[model samples]
Target chain A: MTEEGKQAVAKARAILENYKGKKLRIMEVCGTHTHAIFKAGLRQLMPENVELISGPGCPVCVTPADFIDEAVWLATEKNAVITTFGDLVRVPGSEMSLAGARSEGADIVPVYTPIDAVEYAKTHPDREVVFLSVGFETTTPSACLAVQRAEKAGLKNFSILTANKTMDEAYRALKDSVDAYIYPGHVCAIVGTRLTEELTGEGISGVVAGFTPSELVTAAATLVELCSKSDEPFFRNCYPRVVTRDGSTAAKKLVEKYMEPADAVWRGLGIIPKSGMVLRDEYAAFDARKKFSVPSFKAKNPPGCRCGEILQGKCKPTDCPLFGKTCTPEHPVGACMVSQEGTCAAYYQYGGVV
Target chain B: MCVGLPAKVVSIKDGMALVDASGAKREVSAELLDELDPGDYVMVHAGIAIAKITDDDASEAASVMGEL
Candidate 1:
């Protein structure tokens, strides 16, 4: 670390240690942030009055169980191969996870990127390929690009099952739950700081944060210092190196060309109006939900699993009766336990820290 | 799956860039970014280069704190 970096860390810690404000509840709105916070031991550095909470930032964690049921149905009944990021394979559906279905002869393939799924479909012309498109803005463009590539290649067997969500609405829904937020850096890298800056107009305060120790601490310091000055809201792009004020216009235009906002259900937060993205009508042929006619199952979190409450910042992972015992990562009962970025997974990985 | 990998672009062809994150190398879609060169550093997520990383986080953090 440079001298300036060391000074920044020392100064941030000093400010935090000298904090004399009221009890503050700050939520990190990305699952990756939750993991990074735990990995960096940021919580240990906080004063007793400040608390760090997890928000609905993990895309797979927020994805409703019904979406997984649709994927399982495509794999089992429709005889379509399910291609997805590995996290979604373990997330339980209404009946079973993709992994569970795979055990019972469902063909499930985990790909690192949506483009890889396109390649898989290109190679297997006889088989129907459905990529489980579950992410926020960060991964949504890749899904769009995949659909465009499939269209250009004339690959009739390729489609995507979208559970893609946007962060703007989720932040609005949870505005009253915390004093400020540690925004997901990558999401801002796509959508830019305009939305977050506009959020301050509505009295929502936050800082766009990166995934490094110095970046995380600096964001916390900024929040503490700003919030202490007054009750007014503020926004800062702490991770300016990656997130620009405009973000990526090309990516934004691509998403606009392929997908549109739709009312989507979150596992915990329910359906926030226009919180999710779906392929436009013209691209229905590339949409697995329409192409396969897979029915949406009425779904709910498993009994006694407090993942919903945990996701909303109403409670912590340890507050759930099944968190460490029944909902172990090896055999997760809820989506929160399955994804590495999930809050429950991070808490468990960090020895159930509060 | 939402994790972003900061990688150095080694080569580009037909809207695809071969990136090296740490020691691992792979071809990721570069169609999103308008201008990218072989030596540019970018944040790659889900096999797509999302944004160009300007500097290391240490320096970024220093500048952020300097403003704070």
Candidate 2:
């Protein structure tokens, strides 16, 4: 094993050995950690007393299907070019995905950064370029910057279909709902430890952890220990090198400058008030809602898809009847099985089964 | 969703810094900090350097961690 892996394993073993035979339930909020746990075989090594669960950390999983349909609709427009992160293209919509639409003569392009979307519009000034902006705090600043750049360049053809949400709201929504939270290291790096203070006040214990087998085990063990001690919410940094008391101020500034808090709809969680960010009026020229006149479409969850329950921390991937049988990664019925950082995809990729 | 990390500023040019994180290198904005430079660890989120991390504090915490 690598040195980091060995250290993580040692720490995890120490945590497990110390908490063996104790009753505890811990939930890791990051889908990446969920994948790491199974990938490292930590679940097999963990004591029976400690139960680890998955939370709503996957951005693609939480995105409602209506948003996917809207993107697909935009892709089908005569002169409209749809660009998005690779993960969104294959996520199954109620009727079809963008990939499926592309097969039927829709113009769809996958780009890594949001800036690439702006560049596409700049290159093809006559074409309507829509950047499908989706992510949490980590990617929000970039999407905001893209909007600013579009406005600066006077690229009226450049706009974004934003589905950006903040991490604190999701954490707060899950506080009373879960036993303990294994907070996402990446998300925490943006929001920082201050958000944990509020989570603790609501009686949730949180530990920001990295996405490695050993790091996941350490987080699980810390959670068990914290749960064994008190009902008060605790904020412990297992990923202290990456996360701090205060998060990224510059990213926060960019986000604040270009976007404002707005209500967003999650596939399972319904409409969360002030959980999403929309482009400010100053950058309204880059807003997709204004650029395209998309008709309102009803959001629909796939039949027999328990992604909603899985997202709410009420059920595991195995609890879903279609987990491995009908809803494998190859033929996913929901977004959870589509994205790499999604809970279902994590479970399917690793050795998790229903 | 958001995937941010901590990086150290290695050099600064035109309101941007050549930042390194555990062997990963990328250009980041140095507009937020007052006097950041080489060997300084700063919290990096979404490709931007947000704050200066004190070496003393990090070392003290690392030492405590090593003891653990």
Candidate 3:
């Protein structure tokens, strides 16, 4: 380790220790931050008075079961080819996951990017290709580009199931209990910290940070400093190299070109107002939900899973009776266990950093 | 999952850059990020280069990460 790096960690720890007697709740709204916190052992290393909780950060974890059921409907009943990111394959729905459904002859392909799915749609015009678009600001541009590409190619067969969410909407949903937030850097990479800044307006300290171990630890300490030391809340940009105060203008423009804000349901958080993005009326030709008769059904979490409470930070993953027992990563019973970024998976994989 | 990775730019052509992320090369859109070069590092998400990191920031974060 470099001398500076050692000094940085030491300094952060020293600052963190100063607030030993005060109680604080620091929530990270990004799944990557949750994994990074566990990977760096920051949550355990913090003062016991400082409690760290994972929010509805994992897009896959937060995507409601009914959405999955709708996706299953399109893939199986409609004989459509479903292309999704690697994370969604194992997220179990009411009856089965996309992976399990694939085993039953449903055509589901996992692609690294939506462009791959767009390309697949181009080649196979006989079958309907539905890309399960699930992500935050970071992945929204790619989905937009996919629609733009599909439009340019005049491909009527290409469509998308968009479950894209905005962090600000989700933040407002849980702002009352949160003292501080470690903002997702990738989301800020495109949308910046403006929404996070608004959290500060409401007396919540928010810090945008990178994925590195020291960066997360440092950001956590900064949040502690902001909330414990100051009466005023503010947004701190700890990751200046990649994150700017105003993020990529082009990405936001593309989103406006292709998508419009809409109400969407989260797995645990329920339907947040204007939390999701839907294909704009102009790009309505590429709307998967409209093209298919995907039924609107009320989704429920697995009977014993407390993923809702876990997402809202009301309870920890271990609080769930099935967390490690019946809901191992290999056989997850809840949405929280489906993705590596999910808090349950993070806890299970990283030996309980919380 | 929002798993963005730091990747080095390998080549640029037609508004897209081929990046080497952890020894694996993949094509990423260079639309949002600016001033790209072969050695420059970027955070790649969903086949797009969302942000670019200067060498100084890269080495600083690396040194701090090295001890852990």
Candidate 2 docking quality: incorrect, acceptable, medium or high = acceptable
Q: Rank the candidates by DockQ, best first.
A: 1, 3, 2
Query: What does candidate 3's lDDT look like per residue over A1-354, in tens digits?
Result: 566766776777777776665688889889988888777777666887889999898988988888889899998889999999988998888888999899999999999899999999999999999999989989989999888889889998999998998878788778776777788888998988776777776766788878887778777777787777666877888777788878888899999989999998888777899999999887777998888857787765568889888999999888899989999899988888889889999888886334
Worst 10 residues of 3 chain A by lDDT: A1-10
Runs in model 1 lying further than 4 Å from the true structure:
A352-354
- Candidate 2 per-residue lDDT over residues A1-354, each given as its tens digit: 545555555665776776654566677777667766677777776677767777777778888888888888888763579988887888878788999999998889998667678889999988899998888876777787777778879788989988888777877787665677888777776667887866777677777776545555666666666666776667788766566777777667878898899999987778888999888877777778766777777867778888877887788778899888999888988767878778888877775332
DockQ of the candidate models in sequence: 0.78, 0.25, 0.41
Best by lDDT: 1
Highest TM-score model number:
1
Q: What is the model-wide C-alpha lDDT for candidate 1? A: 0.90
lDDT of 1 by residue, B1-68 (tens): 36998999999999999999888999999998988999999999999999999998888878998898
- Fnat measured on candidate 3: 0.48
After superposition, the stretches of candidate 3 with alpha carbons farther than 4 Å from their true spots are A352-354, B55-68
TM-score of chain A of each: 0.97, 0.92, 0.95
lDDT of each: 0.90, 0.74, 0.83
RMSD value for candidate 3: 2.8
Residue pairs in candidate 2 whose N, alpha carbon or C atoms collide under 3 angstroms: A138-B2
